[model samples]
Target chain A: MAVITVRQAISDALREEMERDENVFILGEEVGVWGGTYAVTRGFYDQFGEKRVRDTPIAESAIIGAAIGAAMTGLRPVAELMTINFAFSAMDHIVNEAPKLRYMFGGQFKVPMVIRAVGGGGRQLGATHSQTPDAVFAHFPGLKVVAPGTPEDAKGLLKAAIRSDDPVLFIEHATLYQWRGEVPEGDYVVPIGKSKVQRPGDAVTVVSYSKGLQLTMQAADALAKEGINIEVVDLRSLRPLDMDPVIESFKKTNRAVIVEEGWRSYGVGAEVAARLYEEAFDYIDAPIKRVAQKEVPLPYNRTLEQMALPQVADIIKAVKEVL
Target chain B: MKKEEYLELYRQMVLIRRTEERAAELYQQGKIGGFLHLYIGQEAVSTGLVAARQPQDRMITAYRDHGVAINVGLTAKEVMSELLGKATGMSKGKGGSMHMASVEKNFWGGHAIVGAHLPIAAGLALGDQYRGGDGVTICMFGDGATNIGYFHEGLNLSKVWDLPVLWVCENNQYGMGTAVERASAVSEIRQKAEGYGIPNERIEGMDVLEVKKAAEKALAYIREGNGPYFLEIMTYRFRGHSMGDPERYRESEEVDCWQKEDPIGVLHRWIVENKKATEEELKQIIADVEQEVEEAVEFAENSPEPAPEELFADIYAEEV
Candidate 1:
């Protein structure tokens, strides 16, 4: 095992997949010559050549639509949307087209494609640029939604997504690129929908994923120091949400807090809380608390943006409230 | 093309017309649900374009896709079954009028969104290009689709990558109720292709032979690695856009004028004038098509609805 940043882990996964499969190619705006807007594929152009590392026009519909087409034809394409905010431009293809093609066609077509999008807010990019709309994509049935919290999960889950014969929306948190964690050496893949117990504890259950997982982990550490141990469950995949670990952890703790970087309403927290109530209602000791972003358009101001975002303190507060 | 091929083209056009006519009746009877877009007059466009394609070449089109499905070798039974929403349908009853496709026949899909399939067509060509294959992707859409961003992006990418694709736009006068003059910046749809640096042409879609010839030239040009070519086939729909369309946009006189140039009628006249087939043979083809459509309706009616468990099936190729 080697410790690496989330960015490095993702880059490694993409490189390994490309090397392993000849049909795998990368396409998006600034993905080739400009070396990716996020630098996730910085050196891929030079290594893979122009045919595989394609630099597309600034058209999200074309980027995603073409990727879907390519996937339909048996080529595995990893399409990057510069940012998840820009995904709205190609929303029709992402939600209506990609997910519906296989099922609507009665299993005649398979979209073995991965759409890697950078999400979350903290750098003060404003309402249009910053968003954690993971739940929105997860709302669809056919498409698989995977968002990894740590470097290990990022590499493993991304590899699994590429190999799966389904369209996967692989969301990477914008602020967690530098977050470091240990990743296994080679050819390892974590299953897509299974939630993992990041920190085992019995006091209270904390449910989160993506950037929220980072904050929850920090909160868990802080609470542990104060003799309040909380269990952290990282939901690796949002769509095929594996509620087994969550329910199991919740049954043990009897109290729970759901944390997410998105809004409190109609968000991941809402779904998890509802499910927890439905499945493990007998174990409940208190009302499940939810720590999430303020239901407001993320502002450009740094302080205000941070205030809108769910922080480690917010997780701690929610966990304590549930306890 | 052989005399048999000409007769086959004529047979396919008549088959599409008869199938859609029966489908209209079924829709009225409440046997077929959702929207039913007929391809009564514009049969020559898809029939000709599909005939020009090699077996390896791919074809994709918009909602008025029954003609294309028939052209690409889908049986009248398959098309009618899909129309009736049966388990034996082309999309196994999932995709209705606008979603018939056969991977075995290299017909990618029957996409409903206006210009959405254009980029996907480019991607199909790109996949072929990446694999060093010479197969061309022929994507058909209506004139109104040219106004959408997907058309521009798909065309631009096809040229930039020099992908092998034939972008065929069936300029059927109006988009739903609005005419091309009102919906598009330029009425000549091929001019939009010029903006993307792709070679293009406008063709008459009333004559099947003419459409076939133009498609052959365009497909050859793309096959020779000359990049994408756009063909704007000027035609008119003989029926309303969909089953319940209140076509208040045009006059009966205009419709009559275009109806006089009906593609099936034009093909029938051409065959008789050119001595391609006998009057008896032409009559026999029409009779055959009517019988096929009748049998298809019976087959679809008798076919089972998809099993209840099928609702959750094929959502993903693998278990979630």
Candidate 2:
């Protein structure tokens, strides 16, 4: 096992895919010379040359639109949106074209494309720069939304996303770029639409994903010492959400807690809670408690920004309430 | 152009016009449902562009794209069936009149949203370039689509990357009754290409020969590994934006003036005058097109409705 940062794992996935398929190319703003904003593709420009590692203008719509076009025809394009917040400019392309091209055309075409976008609110970059809008893309039926917490899932899910016939929206956390984990070397493909039981406990089930999964596990360690054990279910893929493990965990522990960095109203937690209620209503001991970011535009002030985000304390509190 | 080529182009234009006329009639008869945007007067643009296509080249256009679809070889039967929501439709009854795609013929799509396909066109070009292929993607849109930001972005990206693409702006006077002059800040659509450092020119789209000449020039430029080329073909949509549009935006004189330059009528006269074909031969061509459209309408009427189970299918490549 090789310990690598989430950024390196993602870059490895892209490198392996590009090396495997001649049609696979990367296009985005500063993806060439600057080697990506977070340096995820530090040496891609030199290794792949300008044609394969293309540098595009700051036109989010065109970046995604071009990828869909290329994908529809013959090539597999990996488009970087710079940030998920910038995706709003290209919403029409993502919502209308990428998802509908195959279905609307009688399944004659496939948009074999992947859009990598970064999201999170730890940075002091106000509301626009810091956002967790994975739910927005997940709402669309045709797209596969994957947000990985660990470096291993980042590498594995990305490789799977690149290989999938359908379009996949790969959402990464802005803060988790340097988060190191034991990533297995060689060909590793984590299947999409599957969740992992990060930790097993008997008292309560704590379901979370992306950065929230990291926070949930940290909170679970402290709760375990108190003899109030918590099971952690990391939902790797947000769209074709792996609810089987979540349901099994719910069956094991009647109490459930959902943690997400997105807003509370009609968010991911609401969907999971509703599903849990429908599937395991008879096994429930308490109502599902949800811990999500406060409903407001994230502030620029560091303290207020951190306050608006879902923290470890929030997860412990939600799990305690469920218990 | 060869005599056979001129005759074929003429036949295509007449067939498109006849097909659209029958489609309008079917829409009024309630046989075909949903938004119907007819390519009434601008048949020459699609005919000329498709005439200049190579086997590997791709073609995509805006909603007013029946003519282009037919020109690119989507049988009128499938297009009519798609418009009627029959199971035998081009898009398996999923896409209506607004989207008719013939996958075999390299007809990428007839996208509904204006200016959306420009970047897709660029990407198609990028794909060809990546594979070391000389094929180019011809993307068509209305004058109104020029005002869209994607148009600028797509053009710039294609130009910067030196992608193989030919951008055709069919400046059909109006976009849903708003004239290009009223809506566009830079009414001369070809001028927009200069900002992206792309070579651009304007052509009289009323003439098929002029359109064909322009298309050939642009295709050659792209085939030689040059960047994207822009062609603003000045044309007009003789009908309203869609079937329901009252067209209260223009005057009778304006419509009559454009109708006088009807592409099919103009091409028919040109073919006869240039000795490409005799008047009797042209009459036979018209009769053939009329019969073809009649048969297509019958085919669409006879085709069965899409099965209810089909509604859940085609939403994704794999089972959702």
Best by lDDT: 1
Write the residue-wise lDDT of candidate 1 on A1-323 in tens digits: 89999999999999999999999999998999889887899999999999999999899999999999999999999999999999999999999999999989889999999999999999989899999999999999999999999999999999999999999999999899999999987699999989999999999999999999999888988999999999999998998999999999998999989999999999998999999989999999999999999999999999999999899998888778877
Model 2 residue B229 CA deviation in Å:
1.2
TM-score of 1: 0.99
Q: For residue B32, give model 2's deviation from the true position in Å.
A: 1.6
Q: lDDT (CA) for every model shown? A: 0.93, 0.90
**After superposing candidate 2, which stretches have Cα over 4 Å from the reference?**
none
Q: lDDT tens string, model 2, A163-279?
A: 888999999998888889999979989999999999999999999999998899899999988898899999999888879999999998999999999998888999999999999
* Quality class of the docking in candidate 2, CAPRI style: medium
Could you estimate the TM-score for every candidate? 0.99, 0.98
Query: Alpha carbon lDDT of residue B38, candidate 2?
Result: 90
Q: Would you list the clashing residue pairs of candidate 1?
A: none
